[model samples]
Target chain A: MKAMQGYCGFLGLLVSALLVGFLAVLFTLVWVVHYREGLGWDGGSQEFNWHPVLTVTGFVFIQGLAIIVYRLPWTWKCSKLLMKFIHAGLNTIALILAIISLVAVFDFHNTKNIPNMYSLHSWIGLIAVIFYTSQLLLGFLTFLLPCTPPALRAFIMPIHVYSGLLIFGTVIAAVLTGVTEKLIFTLKNPAYSTLPPEGIFVNTLGILILVFGAVVFWIVTRPQWKRPTEPNAKLLQPNGSTPEGTDYSITGDFGNVDKSDEDGEAAARKRNLKLDEVGQRSTM
Target chain B: MKAMQGYCGFLGLLVSALLVGFLAVLFTLVWVVHYREGLGWDGGSQEFNWHPVLTVTGFVFIQGLAIIVYRLPWTWKCSKLLMKFIHAGLNTIALILAIISLVAVFDFHNTKNIPNMYSLHSWIGLIAVIFYTSQLLLGFLTFLLPCTPPALRAFIMPIHVYSGLLIFGTVIAAVLTGVTEKLIFTLKNPAYSTLPPEGIFVNTLGILILVFGAVVFWIVTRPQWKRPTEPNAKLLQPNGSTPEGTDYSITGDFGNVDKSDEDGEAAARKRNLKLDEVGQRSTM
Candidate 1:
């Protein structure tokens, strides 16, 4: 299983690296080759250029890498707390970029005197971004914040997991449609049907996006590929004595921590405590 | 847990129903309202009409529901053989539709003397359809057939699971991009940016596709949502005693079924044998 896991993790990393690299190239092509519009908040098309670059870099690429954090074997050696920070941090960045990208589109529309949320891409993208932002905020309050009550964490954890993954998928869909929307609006000579170089490049980018999303989801959701737990004599303690919390909500424990078994409950408590301890230490 | 499962299953069905309904409406608008081209194999745009309808009906919606078979609680009470058959049957229908859709597109392109596989939508859609077809065939040969050795079944099971889900996601992405491309290519006066009624309709459909994909993936991937095993005394037998082979690969049971314990190994053997027996009986 270890060997298999290592192989799986390696493949995941390879694909993810390709995904990120391809996205970077795509961004370069969009910014450098096709548009040459420098990034800013109010430069019209230049500002709109930031939308795809930042969204791809932050939303698509970074968010994907974040989802597969648990599948990266190298990260398994680190404390679960550190992993959470990475996950939450990546998501936060993605959310910020997505917000900025939205702003860019709106700014472009406003300056151009175009109506907003006209296309399906905009509608879906807006929904995905809003949901992602809300999910991140909820995750921060429930899992990252030291003051979040345990009961509240337990109650909200399931919805958080469901919403997080769903938004990830939704955003990928949005990105695909967004690319299509952009290409159709921009392409004239050697129409999309003509398969011009730019058309081919953009299409390849969309394919890569789909592949990235699929591989990331596969790595993240497959339980068999989950990181192996480190040896902890008190890992399954049914008491609340651990220094740090080892949150199992992501693992879908959903408050059903074997409460009937004192030992199991203690273990759950310890996990969450250790997670919190590690998180606080990192923050400090 | 049962109550929770019931609630979840109900929600899943509702979302799925909405997905199917929305897809139907979207297809009607494309074929009947917007184009009025009707379906055929050689009438140019008329022939192309089948692409969206078949792809959405078979590739997107049916494939999604198939992936969530294990999550449907009603299937939990039935023999695993019946479940597998239903799963395979749905996939078969989806594959057929996808194939027909592809044929329609190529036929339309050929009859109209237009170049094919030029757009990003076409490229990604082609890849997704091919991968999906191959996945279905491999899954059928490996799991549904008796000649496949247990070891091989176990080995291929994970990849099959991963590919099935990934392809499902890819198709959804393809559907989205396809919608965007089609709307942009077709709409003229009151352009897509103008958010004409047809544009709004198509975009709404894309949004629904995203939601459907997200909900289905969530239901299929969540371990807790897995249906409970039925109360057959022979169900857990670790030896080759039962009539049918109840392969549990999608349930993520990698081959290490208590190999350290002879009794456990025997029990697993019995489970598979029973599953095979039940499968054979159903075939008869």
Candidate 2:
């Protein structure tokens, strides 16, 4: 009964995240296409439109899903290794779209002979992209590669999770600033201060983006929602003790055992053994 | 040795957070006083300057310090009740300043006949303030009051922490958008896109705010940095089983026994007993 309730709560939140995320993308499209010029690569303001569209779609929405992939209860039955691949693949796609969006802005600016990277939005957006790239590379090297040491992977896991969420928040900040800058520049006649339809629509879009981020962060941080350790995996402590609530299996080293299909008492026994090891080491 | 290393890390991050936070406030002051018309209430744009100044100092910096107050290593020996009061007091101050900031913007708009709550920045900023107020009230009723049930406190703890961080991120988003809007409107002579001195200074200020946020989030989330369970507090299980690594003593119910200054074997035995209870409950 408890499991069923948890599933319902997770499903409700997941649906809300998707609905809000979809609305964010839809609003951006309507604002850019119907309200402004449709997207293009002709080195015009139309090219710059791709910046917002791609950012909301890829950087904000897709990256958010990647962060919470492990918390999806349905995915719990899958091998941790397979889940890591899915996580990495999603992040890589988000990065590619982000790069293209960055290119769109620069191209439009250079063609119009306008200076770039002067505004706070541009500075923050550039920094977020740089950090995203570093996080992806480090995550891939530490978790994806089988050659990495378990101790090293354990050491990097918390730092990796911390930076991932930080970058997500930074992306949301950049998006909000970019939207404000674009509206202030384009809405001169109506004046964003006067609250035109386009202004109201995009403001709703920003709220949706913020809401999506909040939902994703909640899912990722919930202790109850963490992925369970693999049934037969050996739990290794990096600093002679495992911190509470951390699942070392996240590092993708399941040791030499392959009792993946084990169930009932055997699985319970393995888990107990892991706890006893933690207890003994912590006391020492 | 490990304890010393942990303390050093905590100190370094705390110092970095303070430095960046100070720089953010200083830049905001310089941008407003030296570059703009300075602070005033003459129904001019100058009246709006108080919005950024107060939001950066109170909403962003002080609220951030309040969030991490429990993580201070030196304060681990302090009574958790005293710490709760400190945390609540800091948040209350932040809320008061935030309310004043809101009033400044609204008064400026009303006096100047400008439409209010029109842009994305206003929408998100208002929502963040509303959430902060609700969070503060809920935290006080549950944590500071002696009448609240222990089980209820345990249930609300995670949600409280989650919403606190979420609101902080929302505030940063609002600040960044507000900065962008102000720059676009005010930098008309050379234009914001021209990379003027004032623009660059404020841009750096935005970066400092982001870094400060990143550092605070890091300190709060590190599992190693959590306040230890009280030396003599009884471990209570909220849901028949305790989730891994969670210290239930955070609910502020130390039970009828007061062993606040107990040391040596008795402390170790109490800690071990808590672990054993957790182990036993999990296997059930």
The candidate that achieves the highest DockQ relative to the unseen native structure: 2
Grade the docking of candidate 1: acceptable
Give the Cα error of residue B132 in candidate 2, in Å.
0.6
lDDT (tens digit, per residue) of candidate 2 on B144-225: 7888876576667767877888899899899899888888888988888888898888888889999999998777765445
Could you give the CAPRI-style class of model 2? acceptable
DockQ of each: 0.27, 0.29
TM-score of each: 0.79, 0.85
Q: Write the per-residue lDDT of candidate 1 for residues B84-172, one digit (tens) a residue.
A: 89999999998998898888888877888888988777888889878887887888887789888755765566577768877887788
Please state the error at residue B128 of candidate 1 in Å: 1.0
For candidate 1 chain B, which ten residues in a row score worst on lDDT?
B253-262
Model 1 earns a TM-score of: 0.79
For candidate 1, the TM-score of chain A alone versus the native chain A is: 0.76
Error of 2 at A167 (Å): 0.4
Candidate 2 ranges with C-alpha deviation above 4 Å: A235-284, B235-284
Please write out the lDDT profile of model 1 over residues A73-186, one tens digit for every residue: 445568877888998998888888888888888888989998898877888888988888888887887788888765576456546756776777778788888888777777
Q: Best TM-score goes to which candidate? A: 2
**Candidate 2 lDDT over residue span A1-284, tens digit each:** 44445555766898998898888999999989999999999999899999999999999999999988987755666778888889999999999999999999999999999998898999999999999999999988888787887657756776777788889999999999999888888998888888888888888888889999998877666444556656444344333333222253221111101112112223333444444355456668
Give the Cα error of residue A122 in candidate 1, in Å: 0.8
